[model samples]
Target: MSDDHASSSDTTAATPAPRSLDDALALMRDLRARCEWDRVQTHASLRPYLIEEAHEVDDAIAQGDDAVLRDELGDLFLQVLFHSVVAEERGAFGMQDVAGALIAKMHARHPHLYGDGVKRSWESMKAAKAKRSTLEDGLPAGLPSLHRAHRLQDRAAGVGFDWPDALGPLAKVREEVEEVASLIDPATGAVTNQDALEAELGDLLFAVVNLCRKTGVHGALALDRTNAKFVRRYATMERLAQADGKTLSTLTLDEQDHYWDAVKAEERAG
Candidate 1:
């Protein structure tokens, strides 16, 4: 039966009741079977759509528009239904099974609520769940190098596998900076040792991210905020330029730098 027909039937029943999750799954299954386009969908073919929908959701979230976010979230959710319906047609578990498994897993993981009644701090909870300490266990291999380095150091430090205090990391970062400076050739006015300098610079950055992590700051979030601040300030400068019947593209680097400084000074003064 069509979803509309099923809804009408349920609503018109003598007894009153809320629609169950299974009812929604049943309607999705019926729609998949009867709709010509839906019947032709395969897992491999739907992968692109799933990815696109997820990115749309991300875009809406980034824009900070709740209304667009709600609609985008619904579209992303349909991807879940589409996948489950396809799986069910192939004799795999349906949406109910998916929901049940996720619910069970969540309950199992949250021991303070559903398992042993022990109060747990976030750090203690993480330490309990972490079961390994090798390089492989430190961080996922696929994260961007900076982010991976941050996570790697944070995980290590959590288990007493780190410097005794903040001073140690601070000293190491200073040492890295000195090494990177030495790798530059002053007489030649060029980098004499690119590899060594690059490695030292990377170490310095990693140490900074680690320090941020240890101090209860997120390196990624801080960098993102800085990026947004720069974008906003630059856009403000662009508007000022447009008001003068000029564009940023027509401005020299020095001219732009002056405008940027003025903008930053104005913010500080305000």
Candidate 2:
């Protein structure tokens, strides 16, 4: 063979072809049939792992690492394949069924792209599919409180039951805060009515979420940023304390506060 042709043949031999979807499905089927561990896993058993993989994908996105995001996405895709294989073994459904349903739903939802119909809001389309009797119906009870609050507000707004503007939500926030404050005894600085306190605090959070919605800020993302900021500042405080020959835990509250202020000032100056 010519030298260039020989080099091309060697490169092809060294690099394996990318696996296809069919290859992935076949691998999952084989694992389910032959691997003792894979054979025993159920949907319920894998719930925690699915949640973890999803969070890892989110973390990868936040880090802006394309390689990590690709790997994390692959892990998530495998979970879907594993569940599909399990269902296939039981003769319930398979990956084909899942893909078919997803395609059908997408086509139905995006009429502007797939059909000769006027475009409608996704929320309206989903509401029709939900056939919910109440505004709050179909919301998962397991959703995080802030997310649930946001969804609840969205549902209410869909039916014209929302504040007209940002000012309304801002005012509502102040009202809820006052309600919460009324439940506490100023002298003792303790909540006088625990149940009322809880309810008022929930109202306050819900009002804040409404304000966030009006301002086009996502409550979860905002909280995540704040949490990251706190972590960074606290870590810096710890490092500063250590540099001064004392651990954070060994220092007095005032000393720790001093370091916290220094960290904040340094961050601000930067």
Among these predictions, the greatest lDDT belongs to 2
Candidate 1 global CA lDDT score: 0.72
Candidate 2 — which residues are off by over 4 angstroms? Answer: 1-17, 185-188, 250-254
Q: For model 2, how does the per-residue alpha-carbon lDDT over 150-247 read when each residue is reduced to its tens digit? A: 99888777656778899999999999999998998989999899998998998898889999999999899899999999999999999999998999
Q: Please give, for residues 1-270, the per-residue lDDT of candidate 1 as tens digits.
A: 232321111112243356665675676677787887667777887776776777777667778877677666656676788789899889988887898999986776577898897754443356667666564464545566767877677656666678767777788788888888798876876898788888888888988887777666778767877998999999989987887888888899998887888789879999
For each candidate, what TM-score against the reference? 0.70, 0.83
- Give me the candidate number with maximum TM-score: 2
